[model samples]
Target: MKLNLTTGIIPSLNVSAGLLGFFFVKTWTKFLEKTGWLKQPFTRQENTVIQTCVVASSGIAFSGGFGSYLFGMSSVVANQETNFTDALNVKNPQPAWMIGFLFVVSFIGLFSVVPLRKIMIIDFRLTYPSGTATAHLINSFHTPEGAKVAKKQVKTLGKFFSFSFLWGFFQWFFTAGNNCGFTAFPTFGLQAFNKSFYFDFSATFVGVGMICPHIINVSVLVGSILSWGIMWPLIGNKAGVWYSASLPSSSLSGLQGYKVFISIAMILGDGLYNFVKVLSRTIISLSQEIRIKRKDVLPVADQNLPASPLPSYDDERRTKLFLKDQIPIWFALGGYVTIAILAIIIVPLFFPPLKWYYILVIYIVAPVLAFCNAYGCGLTDWSLASTYGTLAIFTIGAWAGASNGGVLAGLAACGVMMNIVSTASDLSQDFKTGYLTLASPRSMFVSQVIGTAMGCLISPCVFWIFYKAFPDLGLPGSQYPAPYATVFRSMAMLGVEGFSSLPSHCLQFCYGFFFASILINAIRDSVGKKWAQYFPLPMAMAIPFYIGSYFGIDMCVGSLILFVWQKLNRAKADAFGPAVASGLICGDGIWTLPSSVLALAKVNPPICMKFLDSATNARVDAFLLGS
Candidate 1:
């Protein structure tokens, strides 16, 4: 109870309500099937679209989960300086206005990617794993040919959900907490070797590994090995800190440490090159797309975009429904323009505006970053927008200079950059989900609007509850780590001041890696994309540079599971692997709710730390639970 529900915010973030809700929604949709109130035996396409919409809308409605919708965009900055309480003597709804301001700014990126449906979904088949899994989960339940498969999925879903929920409940109540419930298998101690050896039993991550391209798995694994296993010790010894700090700390203490900052400098350098690379590719390709103006496709003069080819969807109405978009580009652009003006002029005046160029840079840099964010999302199942956000804050903050007012302005722009990248990357992935499930782009747009509206109205209230509860959200020993925000906070501070905080070794590593990334990318692009695919991704390499190698290991394990399954039973794995994986993910996500509620109410498990030795821990966990 102390570990899991100590602060009362939800414990598990990966648990999504979409798959769990699918069962109930599916049941409800079927019960009304005969009355023409629903699609009889709800088609996979319809169910997936509706479910996606619901998930997207509800999440965007509030800070429901990490990285989903109510992006802790503010969470990082909250620790820096909270707009949580109104400023002194300001009896204005400044917080409310800022929330609304951010809400409007977010739409700029969300809508920006609509033009790229052709590039992201139609041409390059990025295995957006969750999107693919959700599509499969929806299909498994509804297809007439797969009735048995669907029923089996339902049974497996229930089993997985029950087991995951009960285990998580017991784990939180009984054993340990913090990503540390029997899941991490963390007995090995803090050696780099131990870090390399650990595994994370997250089915959602494994599911992600399952659906994305095998190259991704390989690259991530290679990155983990090359960085964590090989690079750290060299960097540490070079800094002459090996005698004192044998390994990277893996916490904020790690921030000032030589290993982590060296890693950051390297990551930042490579990341900048990769950022430029992707953006250029996106621009060149997008321009080509626009110039050609493919004769088969027309610009959305009549509020419709062409549908991705969905051979499974034979219904004509599906095409009609999917093609129709309610908002026109002109209208959306006009609204965005109005909001940009308000954000730049009116809202900032309340806090006092920065220089004109500061606002101009926020407007300029944000949309440009949005382009490649889609490309990055397509390749890795991640947005890579956070990288953009961190760098943007750093660069823009450095330029804006560090007077009290300038620091505030730079931080404000950091918030904008955060929203811009997050909004673009997040919506792009969700949009891919719609495309895969053959949902209307327009309908998904509306769904996003619903989420955006809900987030605007509700997130502030939800955030206030958490902030009021734990004023120390990002401080030491606080329930909310606001881990990403720590990075943002650091960058904001440094950007305002300069790169003076980075040590000598850190600067050398940064310069070295930055150029190395540039040279590598230039060579790879010269060799053409097919050849480039073999290299470990720069972004993947960056992961283990600061964080531990466990994420790469987990993804590798997940992907390898799929690889082995493919080797053994390719057909069965292709047809049903995703369904099984989705069941695992849904199970974990759904059960987190009850466990969280239990903690919120101050319930404790029967057994706890000192009371349980290895003997008791082992038996009390599996045997007492009868599993």
Candidate 2:
């Protein structure tokens, strides 16, 4: 929870809890073995079970969106909006309801993807990079030669982890107030800083850059340059012409509206394109598979004129066990239907404005969306659960209307959609890991269920502590700003209020960007993969439009580091890059635990590190001398 919240606030630093959990469990298990506490050697399969459980449980933190959807319902957003209403105002989250809401929505995703495991993992052969990486990490730990490499990797991880933690501690002392530390450093210049172009000194984002593909990192940087450097400046010049000059800079009626809506437009355009493309491919693939199967079953006079070429030894063994415990199709369907009914009945009882039919409609369409998300994750290792959630937010929020608590309804629907879509993808990723590890499919599924059950209870409890301890938990400029909360809330507002709320020319800009995104994606696809890799992804570019480019700077720094390391020693960089990156990420992420405690204790940092222009500094000095 601490690590996720820390990373989630920044762009492109959302490290997987499972990846971090792997390090902790591996270290602990090694300690136990060394101390002679274990009766038998800790097998790779057992390690996999632990990893699956961790991923499942920690996933709750990501999906729960305490910092995003839940926070969007809070007073922070209400305070920010000019035309707030009672319907838009939600009470503080209660633990009981939070737990219940998560439980209802989380498991539906698990069952939703069960029937498609073979199709996704076996037939499609999509490269789930994160899952495949994890499987390799686990596999390496249990081998004699690999064990030696693992030890060196662990040592590298520890060294960097210590350094990253201490660095965070050093940085914390200067952050006594808002924008008062290295995070707010004006690395470029005062003008650039005003445009939100600066190095935040965030280790987590740097680590994320190391882990993420080069295209994603570069795309973010390009997006920042386009929006902040050229587009926003051009738009800002139209202040008095395009919007009211007297309006505060933050007003959505002015520049803020353009930022949020334009970003949303690009995101939607990119997501829609990919969703159509992936769905079309999936249908074609499935049709071909059916035809092949039908042909095989038809008249083959020779029982097997020539048997199909045998699979490789490891592949054959893994497939045998994977197929050994087939979760019945009926079971998957029955479980999904049962959960859907429960959610439809129970959710309206808690959130009446959402209506029963709304839930029914969402549930009906959710499975298809879940498959799209899962399949997309397999291909790109990027889960667009939030994009799907945004779709729900607009569709449902608009349907419910502003007079009928549309904001809350939209957020609630988002939770349901996000959890199902997210978990479906996560479970599929774990299935891929299981397939590679040669772990039993039944064990993987059961472990995920157990972990999810644990998460339902644990995630809300963890979030509750943050909610109570931090007085300004979701407020802008606070430690945990929960940036996406504002974005989601703005989306709900736009959905309900319609284009009448947008500033002059905002709608036109949105339209241009929307079509531009689609066109860019079309061109990228039309070009061969060799050239397409260089194209900036619309989705990746859209993120920094709303969130600022500071994190992009951090990520590029990470990319630079990795590039240099690879140049110096490609083999070692390939071997130890993730471990080093994980160290930096985990170390800084874990610091959130103590930082939260300090906030609870009301311990202020000793110094306020801030920068000022020469004129301001001279004035301060003159005033001090006079006094």
Candidate 3:
């Protein structure tokens, strides 16, 4: 009810309030439609939903990924009693120069992808699923005769949103108080199964099952089975040499640690292999087609805010020479050169430089890594930035130092590359969104650049708010797991303090996982995709290992709902299935707003955070559900 600035509580409160307010407006609009108060087939309310979703999406983009590690210091110099503000420099929301450097780097990422635009979007025509879904939702709102369909959709979406919001209360509030309602059934019996094999039950995850292609779902199931059903039981039986029972496992929980290690390796391995496979095949395939296949669920907007006056290429030769409406070569070249000089050559001059060439290497590697991430997204719709960033850690391994300067540089390089990858992937997906809905790609480009500038400033504030609210981050049973920071920290420790201090088997398993992922992907690609459809996607398989079985179970069941419905009536399935799934996603997705508030209030997360604690019989804590 009250505001707290020092605690970073205001930003999350604002977000939660906005989503609640939007839900109310949506409900009122539907009531108006029913009474005929809104005439002309809902002409007055057009563009309302799309605009709201866009804003929500932008806020989410601002919060996505481990953007915190950009400034979070894992190598803290303070005691347990030291206040968090004192420990992490307690400076401004973020370093100002870092903000400037991010802006230049983000802009450079946009510019660097110009050549890739021609090759991936124009020539190969990859269909990014989420982008297509967004395009479809937008098109539904704007097209002629789309108003009626979209109006109906709005009402349906609102009902589900309200339904899911209440449901989220059961999941979070009640669960925190140790009454998770029906969803807690999975944890009732079977200690091994509950702790190791439980699947989350929620409309949102079920919605995911309904929406994702069956092939992807099947792969997810395979991955889940391999880890929880097989690997988990194996670990319980053996307590194997590769998994030390005594090793620190707070950030990366128990058997879950091995799961995280192997899974990450597999994801990176498979993703890396897929990148090469996609890149090579696209080259061969491009020669066969002049233009690639592309989508629209426009179920078309000519709108892109912050519109730039892109040069209209009237020359036939110019059109033939490059993709239509491409950003001018001079602008690309000019932007790249200017940003590179500042980011690569000038920025690092401030601090005492050790291996000044590291920045240069990052300058060279970033764009290439960005392109690889974009390509992977086009092919898989999964961000490979984490994988690439992990790769960067190893790539820079031998050169990292014991001094603070070297670790800082490594984290900087990771941040720069990740920021670029995240930016580029978002751009590529938006480009796909534009292509499907008949929107102007160049105009979308202008809108994205504007958004990037805003994100450069806003993301830090969102991150810091979470930091201030949750003081003991990365501690066991705490909400902010911050696995990526842990990864970066481990890499630094290994480099600075040496490997003898780390769990030996953990490292070995990680490498084995890395290689196994690569090998499985190679075999799958070689066998032909038709056959590969039956095999699990290594990335899909690996993700579930770390994410817990509960989510995997919910997602699998959601997929089955869609699969069975399609089999029953394929045509009608198209008309209603997506709407239902959309409702579930909308409901549960924004529900995080209130959840964040509860979290900041120390409203207590469901027993799940402390599930391991009670399950392990550690001294009972007050936070544990039903404790």
Candidate 4:
């Protein structure tokens, strides 16, 4: 209870409890079905467990997932400032407007999306595939004798839970440090050989194989080649003198300015490229839809025009209901409009006299971006959607009060939001498959959403705690020299600078152009089978080279293992993947939830002393063995 309250784990705890409680409800439902208690045609819908799980999961997942990315972006923003300083120092761990927005919006989204289940699931058949997976597990116990089998499965899951708990603790205490990097100990100069390095001797590879698509996995590899193999070495060596002066003595002294510059350039470039592609695609798509509708209307007109006995096209079909086609657009538009209206009102509240044009621009670009995201998710090109959205926001910002901090912050917020939407859409796609396989849509939806929310709430708090705990990293406060804040502050400094193009705006536009060229080319090529997928490739390039490299290798290894296992024993390997994924998720809880607890407890255990000692011993042992 103490840990639960302190860590904000209560909500998630409630979620888990709720899930378990629903199991009993499911059991009863099954019993009712077996006994013909409810004589409905459809499988006597078991709502309690699945719906509860979906709502809980979506909220948690969106929150946590959004939080993690928010932290990542904020870190980048903060580091932007730290990079320029001779000896950087970050301020108090203040939450940004974006963070607050995410917190409030995520909860609302959680609730909002629930009402959508009926629309998305029952009416439109949106295929809640994850629910199908859960249902399979539940229905496995159904028979003439009631839910005796389900109770046994629950017991089995409980056993797994116990092991999962122990595993989480061990990793938390022994290996994980700062929840930042992988591995437990340093192996050599500026390098470490930990879980960060190995995929636990192929276990991670197997897991990676299950999740990562072939295109993305390949893109990641390509990105690693560009970033780590080409760019990092080339840029670092070419500008060695600047690096020598600017960088700290320790490689990890802190995030260096040069590194930040390069990263900013890459993401900016990639995002711009994606935006143009998306905009063009959206325009074309909307045009086509309009054309199709027009075609129908015009044909009807042609027939009705003259007092002709025969129709013009000879097909006697009138347009029925294109209702299905409208559903996706409506949902996408509704989400965008709501967020845009809120943003418009909120921004004005913070700084009054907001132009209606500002709101209109946001509303316009937002749904276009959302459509791109939803469509991209369908194609499994998450990279394309995110970059496109980022670019769209950047372009819109440039048109709007481009120089303002609010605009830049809004840009960042939009970037983060678009990324989550892409992820959610991707999950939705996965659930589509799961649903086809008879998986439980409700359960899957709940699980994922809950995971996202948990991520959001926990990430900010964890960020704050870590920022406070390690002041040396120049964390906690605005790291980017508060660039957005500076942008805002400059408003007062320059009386004439209102609503005009700033120097930063020029840079943003230039970068956007450069990106647009590359993105357009890539999209053009990717249309046919002769070309390599370029959007995700650039995205893969944009992420940290090391992380991308690891992911690539992990995916490759996992793919290999899956191939071998499936060839030898199909059913076992299939089951194994889910089990491992579940384990990792359960295992992750060890560190994720506990940090919040420890911070709240105020257990000032000298983490540095303990970390250094353990790391040192591990290194010495490795060295001795090597010698």
Q: Report per-prediction Cα RMSD to one decimal.
A: 8.5, 3.0, 9.8, 10.1
User: What's each prediction's clash count?
Assistant: 3, 0, 8, 50
Highest TM-score: give the candidate number: 2
Candidates in order, TM-scores: namely 0.69, 0.92, 0.70, 0.58
lDDT-based ranking, best first? 2, 3, 1, 4
lDDT winner among the candidates?
A: 2
lDDT on C-alpha atoms for all candidate structures = 0.54, 0.82, 0.55, 0.41
Candidates 1 and 2, the one with greater lDDT: 2
**Tens digit per residue, CA lDDT, model 2, 1-627:** 654443363222212343344456667777998898966765666768778887788778878877678777877566665865474446458899889988888999999999999989887778888888878877877788777777777778888889889999999999987789999999998889988899989888888888877888899899999998899999889889999878875578888778778987898899878777777766776677687677678765456556756679998888888999799999999999999999999988778778999999999999999998898788778788888898999999999988888888998899899999999998998899889988888889999999999989988987877887777766644566666777777878888878888899889988999999999999999998999998999988987787678888898899899999999999999888887887888798777678778878889999999988899999999999999
Per-residue accuracy of model 3 over 1-627 as CA lDDT, tens digit each = 111111111111111222333445556777998998975443212222233234323433332333333433443211111222232222223446545556655667777776577667655667676566665655555555655664555566567767877887766644543324445554535564455455546777777677666766677667777777777677755454644565444423346456545765676678678667766754555545442222122325325534434545532332353356668878876887778777766545433322447666776777777776787677767666655655555455346554434444455555556666766776787776566555555666776676676766665555555556556454422334443444454443344444454333666777887888888777886899688777666766665565445656677787888778889998657656666676676677566556666667776754553344354564454447655
Task: Supply candidate 2's per-residue lDDT for 136.
Answer: 85
Q: The CA-based lDDT of model 2 is what?
A: 0.82
TM-score of model 2 vs. true structure: 0.92
List ranges where model 4 is wrong by over 4 Å: 1-100, 103-165, 175-182, 185-209, 218-222, 229-231, 238-244, 249-343, 347-357, 375-385, 396-536, 546-560, 599-627
lDDT tens per residue, model 1, 1-627: 121111111112112334455566667776788568765455555565556555544443222222211222343333333322123112122346546665655566666666655556655545566566666555555556555665555566677556755655555644334333444455344354354546655554565566556776676677667766776556545533423343233332233343445545555666667676666666676666565456446554434655546655544443444445434667656755676676676545544525555666677666666756766666655555556656656665566555434444544555566666666666666666666566667766776767666666565554444444444444422334443333444555556656665544565666676676667667766888889877655544554554456656666777888889999999877765655565555565555555555555656555543323476689778887896
Q: Summarize candidate 4's per-residue lDDT along 36-144 as a digit string, tens digits.
A: 8965522312432344344444443323323222333333333434222211111223546535545444432332333233333333333233434443443343443
